[model samples]
Target: MSTIVFLHAHPDDEASQTAGTMRLAADAGHRVVCVYATNGDHGTLPTDLAEEETIVLRRRAEAEASGQVLGTARVAWLDYADSGMTGWDQNGHEESFHAADLDEAAGRLAAILDEEDADVVVGYDWHGGYGHPDHVKVHHVARRAVELAARRPRYLEATMNRDHLRRIFRAGVEAGLFPEDEGFDPDRPADDGNPIGTPEAELHWHVDVRPVLASKRAALACHASQEDVGWMLGMPEDQYAMAFGDEWLSEPGRPEGIEDGLPF
Candidate 1:
C-alpha cells in the first residue's frame, strides 16, 4: 500500500538498474513511479528513424515502453539534456543535467515525491556504479530530494554486487556461457577508472528477483537505443536470468544494512 519512486539519470537507467525491483514492487500491489532526470538526448539514435524523428522523442517512447514492461504506475521526465560521459564535449553543455544546480534539481524530484506521496525513494550509488557524471549527480540529487521532501520515506540506493559480478563472469567463462572472445574483464575499471559496483560487504540487501526475472529482461529490451544495455538484451533467457536474478541496494549513511530490498 506504499508508493515507491525511482529517480534515475536517463531513460534506460530504470531498466538497467532496477526493473526487477520495480516489477516486484508493482506485483506486490505497491504504487511504483519513475522519474528520469534527462530525456536521454545523447543516447544512440536508432538507424530507422524517420526524417522528422529525433533521439529525444525516440528515447522518450523507449522509456515509456520500458515503464510498461516494468509495471510502473507512472513515468515522468525532468526534461534536462543528457550530460554525456565524463569528458565528452556534451558534458559542458549549458542544458546538461550536470550543469544544473543541485538544489534546483533536487527540488524537482522532491516535487514528484510529494505529488506521488512516495513512501520509498531509490537512486544510484555514490560512484553511480560506474561514475558517469549525470549518474553521480543522481546520487547527490536524490539525497538532497530526501531533505526537500516532507515524507520520511525509506531512502535506498541501487548498486551492483561487484564481488558477485566477478564470480559470475569467471563462472560464465569456465562454463563457456559466453563466446570466448567476449574480452569482458570484470576487474577492469569502468568509466571512472574505478571497479564497478560496491563490495558485497557494503550492500544492505540482495533481492532475489528470479521470480520476476522475465519481466526484468523484457523491460531491458525496451531500451533499444542504449548500446551498453544491448549485451544484456542479446543474452539468452537462462543466462540473463542467471546474471540478473538478483538486485542489490544499500541504505544511505548506514554502514550496516537496515534490512533487505527496499527495507520493506
Candidate 2:
C-alpha cells in the first residue's frame, strides 16, 4: 500500500480541506497519516472562562473523531503554538510558529517522513491555502521534510486556481451563499496582506472529488470551532457539493498535461 502523509497547519485543516481525499485514499487500501502542525489553541473559545482548556480538548477530540471517520492510519502533531495571521501581533512573537526556527521545524517534520516512509507528502500551497503564517510554515516544513527524507516522497500542496476560485465565489454569491460584494480576489500576492490568491501555475495539481462531497462536509463540520455553522447550514446540498468537488495540489513536477482543472 502506498503511504500518504498529509501535513496540516492546525487541527481542523485536514477536515476542512482534504478529509474526503484521505478517506478515499484510505478506503482504497492506501496508508494515510495526518500531521497537524499546531495545537490550534488560538481558535474560537467558548464564552465560559472556566472551560477554556476544555474547548481545546474538545477540538482535539473532534479531530480524532474526524480522523477515525476518514480511516486515517495515524494522527500526529507538531505541537507548535498557533500563529494566527499577518496582522495579529502575536504572530510576530518569538514563540509563534512564524518566528520559529525553520531548520528545527524541518527536522521535526523530517523525522515523521523518515519514520513513515511516505510515498506522498501533502501540505498547504505557498499561500498556505489562505495566507495564514502557520499554514505557510506547515507548507515549508512539509517540503523540507520531503527534502531531508532519503526516500524522496512526492509532494502535494493544497491550492486553488484564480479562475476556478472566481467561479466558485461567483456561484456562491449567485446562490446567496456568501456576500456578493465581499470583493473576493484570488489573484493577490501572499505578501500583500490578502488571504486568498492564485497559486503558482507550475505547482498546481487538480483532483475532482465530487463523489466524496458529503463526506467532506461531514468532516468539515467536525471543525465547528473554525467553520461557520450558519453558513454551511444555509447552503443547499447541491451547491455545497459543487463547492467542495474541486481540490488543488501545490508543488512542482506534477504529471505533465494532466488537465488544468479537477479530474474525477
Candidate 3:
C-alpha cells in the first residue's frame, strides 16, 4: 500500500484541512502518517486543564487523539513552539517554528519522510490557507524537506479554493447565518497580507470528501481543547458539509485545471 505523509503547521491543522483526505487514504488501505511542525503552545487556553498540565502537553494529546480519529498510523511533532498569528509577540519566541532555522526544520521533516518512505507528502499552499506564520513556514519546510529527503515523494500542496469559500460566505450572509457586518471578507488581507487561499483557476485537484465528512468532523472534535473546534462542531450538518465537503490541492509547477478526486 502507498504511504501518505501529511505535513501540518500545528496539531489541529490536520483536522481542519486534511482530515477527510487522511480518512479516505486510510480507508483505502494506505498508510497515513501526520507530522506537525509546532506544539501549538499559543492556541486558546483550555479551561479544564489539570493543575500541572501545560497547553503544549494538552495540544499534543489532542493531536494524538485527532490522529486516532482519522486512522492515522502515527503522529509526529517537530517540537517547535507555536508562533501566534502574524504580529503577536509570541512570534519573537526563539524556539517558535517561525523563528527556527529553515534548513534545520526541513532536515527534521526530511528525517521523518525518509523513515516513513513516504510515497506522497501533502503540505500547505504557498499562502498556507490563512497565512499564519507557522503555516507559511510549513509551506517552505515541506518543499525543502522533499528535496532533502532520500525518498522523492510526490508532493501535493493542500489548500482551500478561495472562490469556493467566498461563495459560501456570501451565501451564509444572505441566509442570516452570518451577519453582513461580520467583517470576515475572504477578499480581505489575511495574517500574511494576502487572501486566504489560491484561486480556483490555479488549483489542480478537487477532492470530494463528503463521503468521509463524518470522520473529518469527528477528527476536529478530538481537538476539543480548542475553542474553535466547538464552533465548528456546532454548525448545522448541512452547513458544515457545505463549508468543508471538499478539499483542494495544487501540485508544484502543474498548470493543469482541477481534476476530480485524489490523484495519488
**Which candidate's TM-score is highest?**
3
Q: Model 3: runs farther than 4 Å from truth?
A: 174-177
lDDT of 1: 0.86
Model 2 whole-model lDDT (C-alpha atoms): 0.74
- Residue pairs in steric clash, candidate 2? 157-250
Clashes in model 1: which pairs?
none
| Best-to-worst TM-score order | 3, 1, 2
Per-residue lDDT, model 2, residue 134, is 88
**lDDT tens readout by residue for model 1, 1-264:** 889999999998888788888998898899999999998888887888878999888888988898898889899877799999999988888889998899999999999998988888999999899989999999999999999998867898999888888888778778878665877665689888988889888888878888888888888788877788888888888778768887999886777753555455
* TM agreement with the true structure for every prediction: 0.94, 0.86, 0.96
TM-score, cand. 1 vs. native: 0.94
Structure candidate 3, residue pairs in collision? none
TM-score: which is higher, 1 or 3?
A: 3
The lDDT for every candidate, in the order shown, is: 0.86, 0.74, 0.90
In terms of TM-score, how similar is model 2 to the real structure? 0.86
RMSD of each: 1.8, 3.0, 1.4
Question: Which has the greatest lDDT?
Answer: 3
Tens-digit lDDT string for candidate 2 (164-230): 7777888888878767778866765554365464533444566677777777777777776664544
